[model samples]
Target: MRAGPLVVVGDTLLDVDLQGTSQRLAPDAPVPVVDLAAERPRPGGAGLAAVQAARLRTSRETVLVTPLADTDDPDALKLLELLEAQGVRVVRLPLSGRTVRKTRLIAHGRPLVRVDRGDGRLHGRTGLPDAAAAAVRGAGAVLVSDYGRGTAAHPVLRALLEELPGEVPLVWDPHPRGAEPVPRARLVTPNREEARTLAATARTARSGGYAQAATDAAALRARWRATGVSVTMGEHGALLCTGDQPPVLVPAPPVPGRPDTCGAGDCLSAAATGALAEGALLTEALEQGVHHASVFVAGGPAPRGSDTAEAEPWDLVRRTRLQGGTVVATGGCFDLLHPGHVSLLHQAARLGDLLVVCLNSDASVRALKGPGRPVMGQADRARVLSALGCVDAVMVFDEETPTALLERLRPDLWVKGGDYGPLELPEASLVRGHGGQVLLLPYLEGRSTTRLVQRAHSEGGEER
Candidate 1:
């Protein structure tokens, strides 16, 4: 939502991933032995939705409002730090006792076991006594990500139902263990199984299919007084139901190779919430949610990592181009990443909808800078640059100039650091011929990569 901030209220959690290979069965137990090789930790539940929503919004601000379980809770502290590092504004409620933590052990790229700990304990329901109601009242859109933790029960539920402004759109990812969302919610999204369980809870009996799913969604919509409900039917797609309207079928886009859809639902909820915040209508938001979920599941299957965002640039670039979004391209040896490079990237990103950094391939860098010039390999450079929030995509080009890649991409904007004048740019004519504007961003003084490299060499000699 570009209009105003998106406020998320729900239980926050920490998700940890233990990845390794398992070949043999354990002697002591029936479970397989998982040889842990890597560990990754990330924000989960509402915290995850906040990050997803923030990324989807691109230019809009997102605020996560939740209560920490305890002051000394390691997960809680880590969650705060992670959110802060990702540029999300967090308004934590009064601390209760413990933050929820979920640890998953995976072997051979599949999860073997999951261990969950901590209680979703928020101190009180006084509408998040500190930052809850205030944020809800001022939010452009609000999302309730109930994870069956104690936080989304009666008190906090009522506070949210009462405090959130009437005009704000609300999307709830309902959990049976949690209290029902307000009837005024724009949409209540539940998976097919959850929808079936909810239907049985409502004492309604029928079959389970796309047809039955619509009926079930309608029943829940009526029960909760919500305007609509959509049941996500995995690969079968999603069934949407609004008051007296026919069920709209949103097909799931195909994902290549093995599908990792663990967080697809969360991505849908986050995308829908952002669209609603941006004032999208019910049908539009639902469709947008489905499309985003497809994109997410295609790239993002891991639970505790942003590996999905590091997908092939071609796919993302084509998608952005198809959407009629502005595409900006810039290139560099990127031998050493410094604040000046980051500044130029940030500014380039602001000039367009998507920023693509055409990194120099290993051979290209070696050709341009001589031997021992590139301190890192092409892959390492691409990985480091891809980690930046401003750089949407990174691709390595083998050519000395990015003219060929720019010609293929036909970028709407070609951005260069201020160090280069218009005539000094080798690819300026090609970009201009393609009707692309060549913009030179100011380079920060005393931030040259060559200077940094020379200084390091001089220092090493001094020590010798």
Candidate 2:
């Protein structure tokens, strides 16, 4: 299910998950006393869609045009950084104000409260940069996630859409605050509530006409002049309507247990748009999207978090493999992440569905590079690596070689940077013996950590 060239345009956000436990109640108030321990940050909304679609590896190229305000918010920078790390080409539209950020306080694995920061004035420039428009024009399919941020309402985006080629499939996730599509969208997806409003606004439907899903979808299709309309019904599924055809009732697969539904819609739209870009029929794309959404919900925060707040285990490899996607593994010291490291990681992610980075522990790094090395602690290194979008999971291994870990995970592919395997490489043999492929990426010239360390030492720097 390889996708062709694809583009995703819309709001970009930083989704921060704060995890901890509330064991005691406050004396002054009834609120539980929570001891916050850790936080996880992920790209949200349009950014997330772009990343997930890229993970499908359906296309030779995928690009995300997102408004990124120039700011010093570390978390926000992290969000944008991960997009590229996850292998999605980025066209950054400058925003004058701060980017939107959503932070949640969670007890166990569920969100207890959410705190959103940022004024509604996230727009700066009025039009898409020339590079952005060209990128969209070249895309096989375009997905728009209008989260009511300014990107969806900008003149440049609207103008571009108005002039876009009709053959380019457009999957639009509409929001109330966003501009309407240019009457030629391939599909528009709105939640039940949003659809009701759209139906009422259409005025063709009498009062309370939204109750009839078909009528509402039809009303919206006509109102937006889109080719098709699908109204997502949270628990039930979606009502898909195209032209004169009777709307099909697609039942979402049942989940056995409670799963996180937070970003299910984004994932659904992303998957479907990618499928559509690859020339899947509308029905086929919808079916695939529905299944992808269900699986995502079933796999979400139901059991990932813990009181200890430990990172996900390597054991998830088996689960991911079973789900049928490429899994890539890379082993390295990763003492100080450099440009070359970033490039390697992004390339690695483009090669697979998920990438597992096997990080060498402090002892192992010390043994390999001798004492007075690493510069950064193992925990620090792992934390930074985990923040990368391309590096889906990071595991600290104490062994000198990742051979044992590779044997355990048996990834679909193994990637290493630089070209030095000599006559025989042990890890290569391990990976190849398990019916897996191995590849070596070219090293970014003059971008090694050792060179930087040496430069620092020459500049009166000491081994910390």
Candidate 3:
């Protein structure tokens, strides 16, 4: 069965990073002067939660339910576009003020300072929109990513949240200034500090570190009437408390360096929400959340400059689907790049917004085409295909067929160049089962890899 959308309910913000170089100290001040470089902007807060959740989901599968200001503020408009571009469907409510924007200045890859502005909050007199209410009711899992921007405090929304069915999992990521989570929240997430502040008991001081986090999580779980509570400890990971059981320590994977943890909380919450939406147990979801959040932090906050148009194969597929674009995939040994291969790739590219070539691994190629086959190594073939304008990405698979990769990618179109019937192919049923179309494109005449190989051998020429 298809999974329902994961609804992220809270405040959205615009986050920008101003990256630059810092050199000699200024003559007039003690601080060094910064030479400006690139400016990167992305969604923050609930918007961030939505974007993170959308990473593994298809277009419109992650919904952001937030209060958006009706004004024409550039930051607000930009945030809206960015969220939509990442495949988040926004269900906007009325806002009483300007949208929040947080700008950080970074020099030499380290954050120097942060400038925050905007007073956006849910309008006091605002009523829940029909669409927003409908989204909550239809959510497979709900994450209240409250940033204390008043969306979580809105009475109409709070009432709606309280009325959700028991089967629906509700995760509340609390903020200091946000309203308390409604009763029956399946889980409540709070950082180490927030847990202490919300629980409001000096007993937390009786312990320190993980012990304190565990105590606070347990206290808050009971106080807030939530089934489970998780206290996130940066780098250390999270402490989960549930039903009088001993707290579980879900450790974060160790990274080589101190990584930027700007959105680690949102990443964790979003990952857990997505897992829960797909019916994972709370413990399993938290484990996934920890792993995903760790990877997210390890990747850091800034994007590395890319010199090529091609992206990682999985990323290409995810990004295409997120942008509501079609993804096309084709598979082959591709031992030798030939005119027929290039022609098929070109045609596949035209059928979708992105084309991923699933190349057979060296082992798989040998298995399928004999030991003497695969004139080129898998790595060289992947590199060559990635350099092609018609190919957005290349994925090498060890399996005899690409059914496993097809299941993972779920491409919109699976194109194959041959004279064989399309439905008879091994991966055709798998692609069709996932709502993808399979098409057989005609091969270029007089262009064959085997023929080229034979000619090269007869002429005493090495394979190209």
RMSD of each: 16.1, 17.5, 14.1
For each candidate in the order shown, give its overall lDDT on alpha carbons: 0.77, 0.75, 0.81
RMSD of 2: 17.5
Better of 1 and 3 by lDDT: 3
lDDT of predicted model 2: 0.75
Candidate 1, lDDT over the whole model: 0.77
Model 2, position 142, has a per-residue lDDT of: 89
Q: Model 1: runs farther than 4 Å from truth?
A: 27-30, 154-166, 201-206, 301-464
**Residues 257-348, candidate 3, lDDT per residue (tens digit)?**
33578899998998887777777888998998897786566453222232112233454454345335788899998878999999999988
Q: Which model is ahead, 2 or 3, in terms of TM-score?
A: 3
TM-score of each: 0.65, 0.63, 0.67
* Tens-digit lDDT string for candidate 1 (94-212): 75667778999876556778999886566765545546666767778888888876556747556666666667788899987787887688889999988888877443355676667
Collision pairs in model 3? none
